[model samples]
Target: MTDPFAPLPRPRSDLTEPPDAPQALTGGSGVLQGRMLLQVSPARVGLLRPQLDAGRSGLVLCGPNALQQARRLRREEQFSGPLLVDPAVYEVRAASEEEPFPNACEDTFAFDDPLAVSLAEQRAMGVTAPMTPTGYLHAEDSDALKAAVRRVAALDDPQVVFAAPVDVGWLREEDSVRQLIACLRLLAGPKALMLGGQMDPLARHPRAVDHLRRIVAEVPGAALLRTDLAAFGALAAGASFTAFGAGSRLRHIVAPGEKAKTSKNFSTSPHVLFPELMHFFLGKTLADRFAGADGPVCECASCEGARTLDSFASNAGDRQARAASHNVAVLMQWLRTLTAFAPGLARQRWWHERCRTAVDRYPLLNAQLQQPNGFKVPPQLKRWALAAPASEAALPRADAKDYRSP
Candidate 1:
């Protein structure tokens, strides 16, 4: 399940100069003078006054709802940072609608070509569409991934972005995995962001960590590696900044492996999952534990205002909706934490302590579940199921400088 000795692809020679050079890639304009990443649904974009006012560095609209919300917010709210919309959102555009924005939001755009505004327009607004990986990789067709990367690289502003999380699913073949990593590294070039996508559900095996170690090793220059809060603490060895998932992935099944099993004891559907017994239950509980943990010590409103564990549990709603909103808030909080750490090392000790604190709490959840058939989950099985657990192996370490500046 882990790729070893994969033929690493050499760096590509096509060096396209960014038309708008020196400007930040995404999310660099808020009151916070650091890097940030946020994923919001369209429904909540209008309500992001808290996020925009909080001084977020940037926001990435994941789905149509998020993109529509961003466009609406752009009209309503006066944001200071770069804004991003995923390409998938543009695909859903109604031909009747005008160009999605008054102007592009960031250095790189994420929408498809038909909906894409002119490069001149993006440059004028300090926006670019540095191609980003959508976690949909076709293993048989490396060229497709490479071609997508090339198209993004050839943009007027060539800032490549990808979020190909290395997890158990990706571990099916070590060579292909290595090739994918090499391809990503090549795509990112001298400077790129290796944003780690969610690996929580896929982490049900120990080899997942091995795969993660290799993925981290192959891309040491990533701007930041984002992940789930609970998983982040459990797998801190591979990352720099501690981050968490936005629950979109949690709500939707990534593959057949994650489908709910009908058990006499507990139904696995989102509606049936309880919010409290996360380890013991499925959906809602899984999301609540990850979002409420404060594993990253994020200082955002959601983290601070979450009066109690119960409050955090209900922040988003029932199962799926809760995962989406809570995770988005957590990711927003992560950006805030990064801002506090940047421009200096003042927050390094605090960051480590936060991670350790979270890691320490993981076992307690398991221990609490073991109260006379309360729910005994095996540590070996537990450890194996994470996307990137800690490893004794000496994986490569990305320099803090890669993401220290705006």
Candidate 2:
């Protein structure tokens, strides 16, 4: 039988180059700290119009909203922070397609179509836009890769051309990984850059860490490292600073789990998923858990604290809007923090205590509730975390009010 997970060969190109060392992230950290984080969803923007005008610092436009809000902000001259738009289609194409952009939706679905708002359009809006390259990593043709790089570079703003590194495990082939890294080097040119991707500790073993480190060594600029909030603790068991995305793991909850058995089970519902959790505790938990491992990272306001996570989670109207806005806030806060601390150990001790206690109390969460198979914590990881100095026993109990972390 063919091994489904086998690494495929990379396309031959003169573009191939060895990975560069992790560029020290210094300037942007301070800009991210203590700012209002805003996200664009149809509903959040409508209800939380006040937040947008009230010192909001960062903006994250995902899915279809990326084009709409970006244009709106530009027209109204109301946007503040450097807007980083990660078109939802970018990830969709990367994760769902096997061949180079097999899922490139060529219609007017808005969010799914990359051409709707080209790099050129972003430049016209005076928006500091960044294209999350989903197809570049997997493209086989040299011209296609060059064209992808050119498309992002055309925007004429370094911040606008951001690239998401390898994430989906299904797309983790060596050639694809190498191609994506190479494209970053090319896209980055000389200016500093930042890249982020998912690295689940429970799923990504020591070998995976080594693999990540190998990838880290290749990038030229500050690379944002993201993981499941709890997983971030596991990854940074001893590192100085760790970066988190409100640790919310922003994803579509359109599908139901293996045991879920109702029409409502497969539909989209924010209250049930707690999307706001990503905004509430992702960064602090990461910092506190690893003793400053996430010491200086960029994200929306929830992590930075401009708006209370609880308030965002329980907003009276538009759960998706609140969550999305919170995510934007967190991203901005992260960028500010990175600038302020600029190489300061991104630290957090509070989250550490809570996560530790939660695991001890609710072992079921650590289990793979998301996976089809029954969840089981790997004994090796459990033992490894236990053996460490900031062991579970050293941490404090979780507070009932502190649902933000863990």
CA deviation > 4 Å runs, candidate 1: 1-36, 47-57, 65-67, 89-135, 160-168, 171-173, 188-201, 213-217, 220-227, 230-245, 250-307, 311-406
Task: Write candidate 2's Cα lDDT for 251-361 as tens digits.
Answer: 211111112223222223232212222213332222233341223232343334433333322334564465555554433333333223212122223333333443353
Q: What does the lDDT come to for candidate 1?
A: 0.38
- Sequence-dependent TM-score of model 2: 0.49
- Candidate 1 has its poorest 10 consecutive residues by lDDT at 88-97
Assess each prediction's global lDDT (C-alpha) against the native.
0.38, 0.38
Relative to the true structure, candidate 1 reaches a TM of: 0.54
The Cα RMSD of model 1 versus the native structure comes to 11.0
Residue 62 displacement in candidate 2 (angstroms) = 1.9
lDDT of 2 at 304: 47
Per residue, candidate 1 scores C-alpha lDDT tens digits across 270-330 of 3221212222234434444445343223233444544333332332345444433444554
Worst 10 residues of 2 by lDDT: 251-260
